[model samples]
Target chain A: MERILEQIPRFFSGPNMTLLLEAAGLTLAMTLTGCLIGFGLAFVLVYLRQTPGMWALPLRWICITYVEVFRRIPFIVVIYLVLFFIQAVTPDASLFTIAVIAICLYAVAYTADIIRGGIESVPITQVEAAQSMNLSRLQTNIRIILPQAWPVIVPPAIAFAVSFIKDTALVSQVGVFELTFRGKELNNQGYSGLLVFGTIALCYFLLSFPLSMLGQYLEKRLATPRGERRSRKIRHS
Target chain B: MQHLEVSDVRAKYGTLEVLKGISFSIKKGEIASLVGPSGSGKSTVLRALMGLTPITGGTVMIGNERMNYSSAKEVRAARDRMAIVFQQYNLFQNMTVMQNLTLAPLKIKKWGKTDVITEAHRLLGLVGLSDRANAFPDQLSGGQQQRVALARALALKPQILLLDEVTSALDPELVNEVLDAVRKLANEGMTMIIVSHEMAFVREVADKVIFMDEGHIIEVGKPADIFDNSQTNRARDFFSKILRH
Candidate 1:
């Protein structure tokens, strides 16, 4: 305890603080870039998976197998596999790119289920109503189905992304200079392990807490239908 | 002239056949009511016409054109000329009553915005829901929602309107309000096929009543002949039991 207290000042020195701050930024960048991209790709994957007819049966099976395989694999194993595979394919690829790719691959698997559940939660009758109106399938999804599905989709998707901020610590295993990696480096440089890791933990909390608050805000905002929300605003005024 | 002709239309849900070679025809501006026991394929007939259920065999002719369900373009062309109202009053839950009425007209049909909005207000007035234009579907009673659904269907200006037990999900007291709206549409010469259990309304407004049993049309005639004087034993027994209440 005394050693931790003594090293705290040195651990938070200007150069050390800059390094930690950069690492925290990298961690945030990795999660946001990976998750945002993954979230988009998950929608495409789910849309393709729901393609109607016998010809699309193989496509559906492929999507299902991808989600099942990645979700069952350990996150560290995914990181190492991505790292080795990317290195073999392009030996000059940056570790940052590899880390982002791994995070994106994992996020797509988890969030595809989230997206599919959100879409399926909408009543089938709504789709029939749209279809009977001569709306194309793509038009039905964009104009009718997705608008109604956002409330169901957004909360869990945001929760997944926020939780992913912590899970990104796995990327440090592949030598990416994120928060956990910076903490290890600081600890190795004679700073107390408790002090370095403790600060690192605070940085992660700082990153995720505001994100969770944003998530709650979006959930509440989306949960109410637009007309009701407008009337609610009128009543409040 | 025959405005719509469905000849030996067949459909199946998996291996079980729901519609087995059903045939019907209606003239322009006529109202045809499909009356039957539950699970008798009355709704399935309307659904098959709307392409909501794939037609396993047979053909539908709208005017002189044969509606080929196997072709996406022709199916869409058939859908463009018709609209269907569901029993559950499946309004788009995220949108307001006015938005629900105008979405297809303004988006799918690409009508002018002001014209679509005007037609929407007119149809809302027709359904007596003009005052609730801004209300979301969940805020309204089932009757009001069904009326809005009727108005939404009308907003499309469909030549043929299909009502699949539109009031089945409503309370008894609320049934007449929806029926009254349909009555008004009938008076306006809008061609319609209504799948209904409301015998009195069917007798009053329907130009023809077709009785169905176990996926087959047991009888088709004027409302008086079918209700008061059914031919088939199945139709007679079904009507006596239902009409006695």
Candidate 2:
């Protein structure tokens, strides 16, 4: 306890603080870049997985297998596997790029199920009504299905991303220089382990706290019916 | 000339056949009501016409054009000429009544925005829902929603309107409001195929009443002939039991 207290000043000095700040920025960058790309690709995966008729059966199987396989594996394993695979294919790939790719791969698997559930939560009757009106499948999804599905999808999706701020620590195993990696380096350089890790923990909380709040706010806002929200807006105006 | 003709239409849910070679035809501006026990394929017939169900072995001819469900473009072409209202009042939950009525016209049909909105307002007035234009579907009663659904279908300017037990999900009191909307459409000479249990309304408005049983058309005649003088025991027994109440 005394050692932790004594080293606190050094731990939070100008140079150490700058290092921590850069690591934090790297962590946030990796998570946001990976998750945003992953979320977009998850939609494509789910759309292909739901392709109608016998012709797309193999495509459907491949999507399903990818989601199931990646979801069941550990995050660290995914990063290592991605590191080796990318190195074999393109030997000069940066560790940071490899980390982002691994995070993206893992995120697509988990969030694909989230997206599929959100889509399926919409009543099939809605699709039928759109179909009868000569609305194409793409039109139905964009106009009718996805708008209704957003209320179900956004909260959990945001929650997943917020939690992923911590999950990104796994990427440091491949030497990506994120928060955990910086903490370890500082500790090895004669800083107290307790002081080093405690600050790192605080940094992660600072990053994720606002995101969690945003998720909660969205959950409450979206759960209200559109008419009620409109009425509220009118009343406020 | 026949406005819509479905001949020898067959449909199946897996190996269990639900519609077995059913045939029916409606002239321009004619109103036909299909009545039968549940699962007798009355609803399936309307679904098959819209290509909602796979018609395994039949052709549908709309005016001079034969509908080919095998080709997606042709199926879409067939769909473009018709609109259907479901029993559950499946309005887009996220949209307001006006948006529901105007979406297909403005988007799919690519009609002018002002013109589609004008037609939407007119149709809403026809269904007595002009005041509920900004209301979401869940805010309205089932009857109002179904009426909005009818107006939404009309906004498409479809040549044929299909009503699949449109009032079945409504309360007893709500049933009349939805039926009144259909009656208004009928008065305007809208061509329609209504699968309904409302025998009294069927008898009053239908130009032809087709009785179905076990996926087959047991009889087809004027409303009075089918209701008061059914040709098949299945039709008579079914009608007597439901109509007695």
Candidate 3:
């Protein structure tokens, strides 16, 4: 136990500390890029899924297939699949780039599913009222539907973002040096596994604690009556 | 010419027919009230007229413009000349009452901000809700919300107004205020079709009262002829059951 306690100080001050810091930066970069690109692609897929008329039928099917395949398969399997394909197509692609691409592809499916739920959560009467006013379909969607769905959409979206940040650990499997990968390396280097892993867990907590707290804060803020009025007042003003 | 006309309008929810061969017409400045028990398709008639429910069969002409229910553009065109106020008031909860009134006019008609606000204030005053203009729907009583909804519908300057039991969802004490607003609108010669359980109000205000049963209009006549001297046994039976309460 004393050796483990002593290792904590060395763990923070040694070469492994530099490796951990670099990996932490990479982890953050992966998470942010993955969430942004993934959400953008997911929004497009959701739009295609809901687009009217026969011309969108094939596109909708493709979107459905994509969401189903990504959401149903394990994330690690998706990481492997993305890694295998990228390596086959371009053997010299950077490992970090491959990891970001893999995380993004995995996140897209869940984001779309959550957004669809948010849209459905809006009441049918809101649409009916918009239509009654002769607001065109597109007008109603943008002005009425989206505004009402936004409060409901945001918290879930932030929740997904926090999870995606944690899910960046999956990238370490493809050998992108991130927090977990660095911790594994340090453990192999003679430090106690408990101290090494405990430090890594602390790093992850440092990153994710704020995000989870943000999600909870937003949930309360958006759910309040005053929040509803304040948001609408801002929009109108 | 009739302000609104429907003939042989057929609508269904899935395989269950809600409106079967329903036909009615309201003159340019008349109030027609549809009254019946629940599930009699009174509300469905209003929904079908506004294109909220798909018209499975038949024709609707709004001010001589034949509506093609299957075409979204044509349906929207017809709706522009008409607006329906729902029983639930269905106010946009995320908007202030003033914004609710102005959103449609500003968005659909491309009206300027100043004109929309002026018109919104006028409508709010008309509904006796000028003080509540800045308030959200959730902040108002049910009656006030329904009145604001009525004013919001009128802000569009529609030639025909459809009211689907607008006062039915309000507290009993609050119903009279909404009815009074409707009565004032009627006095102003707004062409309207109302579906209500306020039988006394219907008898007093409706130029023509149409009694519906199941999926058909059982009787259509002048209020006195229908209420004081209903010809159909079903109509008399309905009146007796309700008037008893």
- In terms of TM-score, the best-performing candidate is 2
Regions of candidate 3 where Cα sits further than 4 Å from its true position:
A1-9, A14-18, A52-59, A86-94, A185-192, A226-237
TM-score (chain B) of candidate 3: 0.98
Rank by lDDT (best first): 1, 2, 3
lDDT of 3 at A130: 93
Model 3 chain A poorest 10 in a row by lDDT: A225-234
Highest DockQ against the true fold, candidate: 2
Q: Please report the TM-score between candidate 1 and the true structure.
A: 0.95
Which scores greater on lDDT, model 1 or model 3?
1
Question: The CA-based lDDT of model 2 is what?
Answer: 0.91
lDDT of each: 0.92, 0.91, 0.87
* DockQ scores of all models, one per candidate: 0.69, 0.77, 0.67
RMSD of 2: 1.7
Docking quality (DockQ) of candidate 3: 0.67
What is candidate 2's lDDT per residue for B134-187, written digit by digit as tens? Answer: 888978998999999999988999899999999889999999999898998899
Give a tens-digit lDDT track for model 1, residues A62-137: 9999999999999899999999999999999999999999999999999999999999999999999999999888
TM-score of each model, paired residue for residue: 0.95, 0.96, 0.91
